[model samples]
Target: MEPAEMTSLRAALAESDFAKPPRINLRGEPIPDGLTTAVVYQGHEVVTDGSKPLRGLDRVIGGS
Candidate 1:
């Protein structure tokens, strides 16, 4: 992720009710499971292990 985008995401996460800091899973690292995950890549194809992006991220605010 770009620095500015990462910063914004961090700030937004901090102000939210996420129980833990978001994990940054990089290539060669084992991907986490059973949690909300966002796989960001520069391409039109998405190859998650069956994970999906959270629709309406606003709904996650305040731990809802």
Candidate 2:
């Protein structure tokens, strides 16, 4: 991606409610401080606890 696109993407994510990803992993375990996880579902990155869709992820990722 271009720098401008990356900047826009970062700005969008920063302004999103799911910017702070879930604390637990897919296994439902407590994530340690300073650590994070990336979960992909149906070819899209989602902020879930193995159940719910991200609060604002659909807008960010343009998923239906």
Candidate 3:
């Protein structure tokens, strides 16, 4: 994919809401500090535990 296309894909994906990932507590549970934390995006629990971003907005949304 072209550089521009790739960039767009990442943005959309980043904005998407998702379900709770592994080792996550959504019941007002408190998580320890710096304990191999997971990445939370738009109320979505990303199991990848990474906030580096996955895909661009357009591509992630299956547009271009």
RMSD, every candidate, angstroms? 11.2, 9.6, 9.5
Which has the better lDDT: candidate 1, or candidate 2? 2
lDDT of each: 0.40, 0.51, 0.44
Per-residue lDDT over 1-64 for candidate 2, one digit per residue giving the tens place of the 0 to 100 score: 8898867766666556443565343546754553343545334454443344555553456522
Please identify model 3 stretches exceeding 4 Å from their true place.
Answer: 18-61
How much is the lDDT of residue 42 in candidate 2? 36
Instruction: Single out the weakest 10-residue window by summed lDDT for candidate 3.
Output: 49-58
Q: Could you tell me the TM-score of candidate 1? A: 0.32
Return the top candidate by TM-score: 2
What value of lDDT does candidate 1 attain over all alpha carbons? 0.40
TM-score of each: 0.32, 0.39, 0.31
Candidate 1, residues 1-64, lDDT tens digits: the string is 7898677666655454343323332344455663333533332222232233323333332234
Q: Give candidate 3's TM-score.
A: 0.31
Q: Give the per-residue Cα lDDT of candidate 2 at 40.
A: 51
Order candidates by lDDT, high to low: 2, 3, 1
Give lDDT tens digits, candidate 3, residues 1-64.
8998767656666565344224342334444552333444556544332333433322343364
Better of 2 and 3 by TM-score: 2
